[model samples]
Target: MSAIGTRAGTGAAGWVLADSWTMTRRELAHWARQPVRIVVGLAFPVMLLLMFTYLVGGGRGVDGDHAEFLVPGMLALTMAFGLEATMLAVTQDLTKGVIDRFRAMPMFSGSVLVGRSVADMLQSVAALAVMTGVGYAVGWRWHNGLTAALGAVGLLLLLRFAMLWTGIQLAMVAGRPEMVQAVQILVWPVGFLSNVFAAPESMPGRLGAVVEWNPMSATVTAVRGLFGNPGGSGGSWAAAHAELLAVAWPVALIAVFFPLAVRRFARIGG
Candidate 1:
């Protein structure tokens, strides 16, 4: 009897994986149909990198080349910026009743969301690659070995994964496609409040403390260390433990939002 039950459970898990992969492929198919959207998403961040590196350059309290300071921060910023695209897609699906159709199918719960996230992560990796190439073109180099550079990329993607769920929850909450734009506008302040473009120590005292504690700031600081670039000049405890905060912040966000998003989706039609 126990063996039968174990096989049953394994079969159920297999369906879940298969269903998720199908949904992921469905989302990826949109790239071929809407190639321009993907191109614009990839290009916007490259434009931002060039503008900051040349047009509006100079990061206060940056110890070395500003590109060294800016590029990692920009990578972290890139993760934060494009979440609106995912949110918009989710809201569109919800409004258009695509999710309803999916729900009526014989699929595992939350598999659609899982599939959406996987697709978004693939785009994020593409964005990271484009930004990395552009950063190199603009004088940013990782002084660390390849392993450390890869670790930095890992941390950046971890942040993106957390942010992905948070956006999903918001998209569900917003419910309508038009409301996505309003909710997405809120993301910009959160991205800019970090030490992404400048050192936290260069800000006013209280604001500097706030920036230092921002999740994006934690990631920027940690990645800078990984890439052997200049970090913020802040002397606080958060600054001292950025690597810890970098991991903890994203994990904490995922813990809070992932289940919340799943719960929200589960309750949608109930």
Candidate 2:
């Protein structure tokens, strides 16, 4: 190849790596400056875990260690809560013209979106660690051993990645910071309407059936199964469907939303 061609190839490769790195570093720096957000994110679920396990988890006749039952549900909810952060960041970038600046720069087109997803995954991992440590402090145990524990973690990460894409797509569609709050109101219903805090069977007839099929419900059920937690409504369709839906739904969601998020990013500031 010509010397100019060689240089061009090297530059292209460097830009790809550097763009991702720059985006990641920028996100990390932003988090470092606003550590309170991370603290609040971790604390919110921990408080819910404590309240449910002590106040309602035991009194409701849910069998099993309450902490054990609560921990897996909290893990799933923690991931659901992270969507707000993703939406906020993406919206802020859009409104602040940061994305417009990125468009003018010579960088890999895919890097910003990929980097946002990766950084959010890392944040999820940190939140998981904090929540797990708190769970242990409150007497939760994993009787199913290391493999199952790792499997549960893997499921949580998969769910986070899928949700991150959804959040990004929402931010792109909304295109303003003010819209993030309106969008976030949808999260609570989607979360509480699931089996996160109670068994589907315990819900009212029609509501129970819908909760049984919720994607978050599938994840909570599968993780609880993996963790050997009790009160999972054994022998139901959810029990049978949990494993397949837990993996497949997230994969399918990412497959649908990821490309859409990228397309939205391309059209930003246009």
Provide the RMSD of all predictions against the true structure, rounded to 1 decimal: 4.3, 3.1
Q: Please provide TM-scores, in order, for all candidate models, with all chains considered together.
A: 0.92, 0.91
The runs of at least 3 residues in candidate 1 whose Cα sits more than 4 Å from the true structure, single-residue gaps closed, are: 1-10, 58-64
TM-score of candidate 1 relative to the true fold: 0.92
Cα lDDT of model 2 by residue, 45-149, tens digit? 778888887778668875557788789888998898788889988888777756677888667877888788888999899989988998898888887999998
- 1-270 per-residue lDDT for model 1 (tens digits): 445442344588789898889989998998889999899989999999888887777433333388888999999998987578778878887777677888786678688898899999999999999999989987899999999999999999999998899889989988888887787678889999999887887899999999999999999999999999986668999999999999999999899989999999988887
Off by over 4 Å in 2: 1-14, 58-64
Full-model lDDT for every candidate:
0.88, 0.84
